[model samples]
Target: MTEHRPVNITGLALKIPPALIFILWIAMMATLRYIFPGLNYELFLTPYVVGLFFILGIFLVLAGFFSFRKAKTTINPRKPEKTTAIVTSGIFRLSRNPMYLGFLMWVIAWAFMQANLVTFVFLPLFVFYMNRYQIIPEEKILLSQFGDIYYRYLNKVGRWL
Candidate 1:
């Protein structure tokens, strides 16, 4: 008889929820804005740009939420294994992780509102943290759960637009 070892799909990292991460990033940006007043720059259409991105972000988030609700799947990022269905309809068609993308847009909107170029540096860090700690682990569990169907969906949709 051959002995088999089960694979550890869950990641070994700080499994902070995506919403908390978003809040932390926003707070960090706010702190930076206060700490370095010289870094601020005035933009002509800051309000319009910020409003547009904020609204778009909210829309993406709601669409993603509704899609998941409609699918009767779990939206909790910390437990991808709990996801009952692979959502591939509506906003999911455009982005594999529309909710995360929405959060990213909110960050962008905050950056614009702050009008601080230095704050933009946090954007890539946000992406890196999300990909490393959150998305990758979830992807592993999802791949194990949905197999080729998930892979096909991944190949079809962009992770973020």
Candidate 2:
């Protein structure tokens, strides 16, 4: 029998938790808002728009969480290798990363509530950071774990929709 070694697919050395990253981005957005007070400009029915997005974000997150629970797979973002099964049903079918997408929506809602154009800059930054440090690493581990099945799923689904 040959010995097998687990591959270190996550190239990132600094593994910041996704929640912490979210908080940090929120802080950065707030700081930007404070720095550029003149940038604040509200839209008509801004509160209602913010509320709609917030509720939608919350719904997506809950849907993703419940789907993972029903699949009996690990939802912990940091431990993709521990994911026992590939979740392809429910919200997972719509977007491969519904939880992250939900979080992105929440950030967008917050930015809208802030009514500052400068705060909007953090949205793309959040996506870039998640893609580089979180999503890519997780995908590498999933591909290593589930192989062709995961590849097929990846092809079938959008990363964020």
Tell how far residue 110 is off in model 2, in angstroms: 0.6
For residues 1-161, write the lDDT of model 1, one tens digit per residue.
Answer: 11222336545433788999999999999899989899999999999999999999999999999999999999988778788899888999899899999999999999999898889999999999888888877776777777788888888888785
Best by lDDT: 1
lDDT of each: 0.87, 0.86
lDDT of 1: 0.87
Which residues of candidate 1, in runs, are more than 4 Å off?
Answer: 1-14
Clashing pairs in 1: none
Model 2: what TM-score?
0.92
Model 1 steric clash total? 0
